[model samples]
Target: MSRLLVTGGAGFIGSNFVHHVMEHSDDEVVVLDKMTYAGNAASLEGLPESRFTFVRGDICDRELVDRLVSGVDAVVHFAAESHNDNSLANPEPFITTNLYGTFALLEAVRKHDVRYHHISTDEVYGDLELDDPEKFHETTPYKPSSPYSASKAGSDLLVRAWARSFGVRATLSNCSNNYGPRQHVEKFIPRQITNVIDGIRPKLYGQGLNVRDWIHVDDHNAAVLLILERGEIGQTYLIGANGEQDNKTVIEKILTLMGQPADAYDHVNDRPGHDMRYAIDASRLREELGWEPTYKDFDAGLAATVEWYRANEGWWRPQKAAVEAKYAAQGQ
Candidate 1:
């Protein structure tokens, strides 16, 4: 019965979290989202507006954030500029939204004295050396390279600082790559899925050897609920499904699930300064909070996701075309 304020609740993971919360608990959820390019209201279709409230606003608006944080028992902060390519093209929004937006949220929490949960990415830990590439723990030193990761790192530090300085109830979680239905086409998995379905090549970056720890969006949402309910204040938790796959390997798996072949896609130039790998040590989350994902294997999840996109063409067609048009215009 918690009154929860979920920032970015219209995006893929956030929308999934909202649905998860609605199904698993009786808590009242108020979703505050800017409804950016990646934030689609369709993701939350059929959700009742009575129990679930939606507010169109940016996290950087201190007054709006303060007003929204008021009367809410907790805040799950997820609003941000998440696309690395867009961040590379323009880092201003990432700085403003990720960094200052987090600051504003922290201030609101400090004033209201509510529980704050900061959602972050594994990129903040930077590239793992190929030789080891061992799982990243909570105390791992942050070595962000790109503007997006750097901004997330900045926000992470700000959250911890607020916990120490102002005694705010702040908890942060860094997660690996999430793949599931309703994901934006710009992300790797969805992009590949839509491309293959549309008779376009699934573009591979570099030799496609870069690895990422994968987690289903449902798993991520469940882990966040566990953290919000039972996690320690002033602590950080890493959430991953322990499903690690390299870029080419993931593409091949998706193709197999879709009855396609590796030859369906062509190798493309790698992005400059792309991190080779990102993994997370989720042991703390499991041992501390008893949070182990039901979807431990990505193969079945990927198959289901592929089937979903195949059946939901009307939902993704326009968005996919717009994304492809943007890339084509850029000569990418």
Candidate 2:
């Protein structure tokens, strides 16, 4: 069995990917996580100890990264300071973790000749006009609008440079918005879901016209596995399920599904420099790799997500107060 090292394994997408690996494969996994506010150790609960091992550390620690890279058959790099609001408040951590940390891992993997995959976001391509029919493809030009996206874009470039200059066997995937279980309450979907649970009005940004191309975390992870196993080295793939919905519609659906009035939510000030929309064109991944999303029905997937939050209040409640308090301070 291959031994895979998953950085940021305690965080939302990383933790979901770990679960995906365990459920679908015989591969052993080593999770290296820094346990930030978004990283919840409990998310990895009940995983078999024989197949899973957790390491508490930072990816920026070059010595530690070198040691870990030397042992793994491949490295799936997922560690990053990923929140746009948090990055706007303080861009330093995003630069440090997303850029410097990625540099450190790239160096280690290059030295060890380990296979690598970099997990990134489509925000790296900036936003599209609300009326535009074009979606972001693998060939989209980089035009990041926020510190978070800029840092991620920088990290993606590093992987490319390393793959070409040092012959590091690496692949990359830029995925659209993801929603599923174990997501931190600070994110859009979970924040609204948890607010409803606490008898508070869900807050919408601006007129709630900004669009996101949603994909289930499981579908994203499934595509990642396909890319890691069969994708050509040095190629970048875009992963999306074409589940596009405006902020208004998403919140309304959530309200309706949760037994509340569709217009029950409140409108708050939008974040500065908010992108109007993000859509992904994942044709390369689909046609070349033969990968398809199981969670293609957005409404059904979203309903399932709502049910997960309703039943797992204890998992998200502890982080709700602080997240809302932070948003309140920003007038968002």
Give me the candidate number with maximum TM-score. 2
Find the number of clashing residue pairs for candidate 2. Answer: 0
Looking at model 1, the pairs that clash are none
Best candidate, lDDT: 2
Task: Tell me the tens digit of each residue's lDDT in model 2 across 221-256.
Answer: 999999999999999999999999999999999999
TM-score of each: 0.98, 0.99
- Candidate 2 stretches with Cα past 4 Å from truth are none
Candidate 2: give its CA RMSD in angstroms.
Answer: 0.6
Please give, for residues 264-304, the per-residue lDDT of candidate 1 as tens digits.
77787778789998888999999989888888778988988
Q: What lDDT would candidate 2 get against the real structure?
A: 0.95
Model 1 C-alpha lDDT versus the unseen true structure = 0.91
Displacement of the residue 6 alpha carbon in candidate 2, Å = 0.2
Q: Considering summed lDDT, which 10 consecutive residues are worst modelled in model 1?
A: 261-270
